[model samples]
Target: MTFYVCIKRVGDILLSLTAIFILSPVLLVSALLLLCTGEHLVLYRQRRVGKNYRPFNIYKFVTMRSDSEKSGTITAKNDPRVLPVGRVLRKTKINELPQLFNILFGHMSVVGPRPLVRSEVDMYPEDLRQIVYADNQPGLTGMGSLFFRNEDDLLAATGKEPATAYREDIMPIKGALEAWYRDHKGFVVDCKIVVLTAWAVLHPGSAPVIESFRNAPGFPEKELTDYRTLLARTE
Candidate 1:
């Protein structure tokens, strides 16, 4: 295993265990609520990219009706598949808890690239494919997740095809962040991203980097400031 991957395995396992211990009560309650509401599975899995250009199933709490991916991979915040409580979980960033196991398994990092679903993986550019696969391990959180944190809502607001926005706008930005991560990979930067991620989860309004991709150094951000303006004026 790679150095970070090995470290990730230990860290993720410990973190998963600790989180499970601390949150088991909430997990149980959440599970029962889902069951009572006929939500079925309390855990859900999907094919995601991981270290060395391989595919692995990623874990998440079941936040959507089963077969939620029967259509396409992009999730609009208003997606009918999202269960009521799922929305809260997703919004709170709690839905991603199960990924701790992925970290433990050494297939991911506490900070790295967000694992893309197989459906979305092809959207990555040819240049970035090798860059990501070199490390192969995905992350529980990463640069892409930080930048596109409001993506689902953006899609919902656009009323355009989610695929179009993803391919044209979101994926390009994601590619840029990944390239940055590839060039700047290190423990300290990972730490920064982790802290930034916590802030993002707690107060998404503080996402200054996401606000202006135009100034983000990598993305073609001319139109994004316009979106930011709309969000600010409306807010």
Candidate 2:
């Protein structure tokens, strides 16, 4: 795991710096649009669970109304706080590009479980903590993220009860997916996930990545069972 972390860290740092150069125009445009909308801040920093379950402020280019956290951490599709450009950023996953900086600083990786906010981390089922954030750094892109690319819409569609649906429906599947990544950590699998992420963002389709997950092995049975329990309840 340490070797993986070392490899992942160096890989991410180089890539993040390169990403910043290539995506400068997009970031500038996003920042300007956010300003015009009176969103003010160009970046949003929020506390998220990190390696060793430590809390750290994760950075993201601000995409919603300032003070959006007054409502909550999770963003549902059509969330009123979403700025005009924010929607585009979210759709293209451009919003996450800045976190490459996080990777450079050792707060994130190119592949691993997406970090959860402290509040949400506390809500995670304690019994499953080991599998949830066990190995691999929380990454810029990951299996769970690939699986739930449309999550904001799903949560929003829950309508007046976003919290309930998120807690019982959305969260559990993410847990299963992340736990799958945790136990199956390896370079080949990691590279495959990163490739899937790129394909998903660039192509905006489900075919390739969906097939990959369906074929992936070593996803913990307990996690899948827990996921089913949640799905059954949600249904």
Candidate 3:
């Protein structure tokens, strides 16, 4: 690995360990709550496309019914599969805390493209598929996750079938965002993305995070316009 890559890996290990330590209480409570209610599952693991197109199990807290995938993998706004406690977890992003372990284990980074499921990966723009994750490990949070923070609601607002909207409209923009991150990947950029992710979680719908990257090369203009138009319809 290059010096930057080594440093990033080290940072991921240290930050993930620190986060797990600091958030142990929240993690414990979330786990206990899940185990006691909502189909009684704590952690949910599913295969996701990783660096170099490898498949690995990505971890998260169970925020939906055990049989949720049978209906569809694309979760919609007010999805019926979501449990009562799940809404809290998903809303506050506590459900994703288990992924700190994934970071610590070197399966992911602190900031990179958010990992996608096999089906979603297949939907990526054909040109972007090979290079999106070629150098960077999938992340717990990144540009795609940040900009599409309200993806469930956006999908609902599209008024098209969830899979169709995602395949046709969402993935193209998400793919471009991931490519942008790849082009700008570095220590400072990663730090900015990490802070922006936290900001998005704490202040959902308050502002557009994409504005923060107004000068970024390869900014997805048409996709973003379509995204905002759909978002406006939601309100």
Pull out the clashing pairs in model 2.
none
- Which regions of candidate 2 deviate over 4 angstroms? 157-160, 220-235
Per-candidate TM-score against the hidden true structure: 0.83, 0.87, 0.95
Q: Give the range where candidate 1 is weakest over 10 consecutive residues by summed lDDT.
A: 211-220
The worst-scoring run of ten residues by lDDT in candidate 3 lies at 201-210
- lDDT preference between candidates 2 and 3, better one: 3
The order by descending TM-score is 3, 2, 1
Give me the candidate number with maximum TM-score: 3
How displaced is residue 119 in candidate 1, in Å? Answer: 2.1
For 71-156, candidate 2 gives per-residue lDDT tens digits of 98888767888878788888877788778788878888888888988667555556656667765578888877876777776565
Off by over 4 Å in 1: 1-9, 157-159, 208-235
Query: Which ranges in model 3 have alpha carbons more than 4 Å from their true place?
Result: 206-208
Which scores higher on TM-score, 1 or 3? 3
Cα lDDT, model 1, residue 189:
67
- Per-residue lDDT tens digits for candidate 1, residues 148-230, read 67778665555568898677666665776777777666777677777777777777763455643334344435445544543
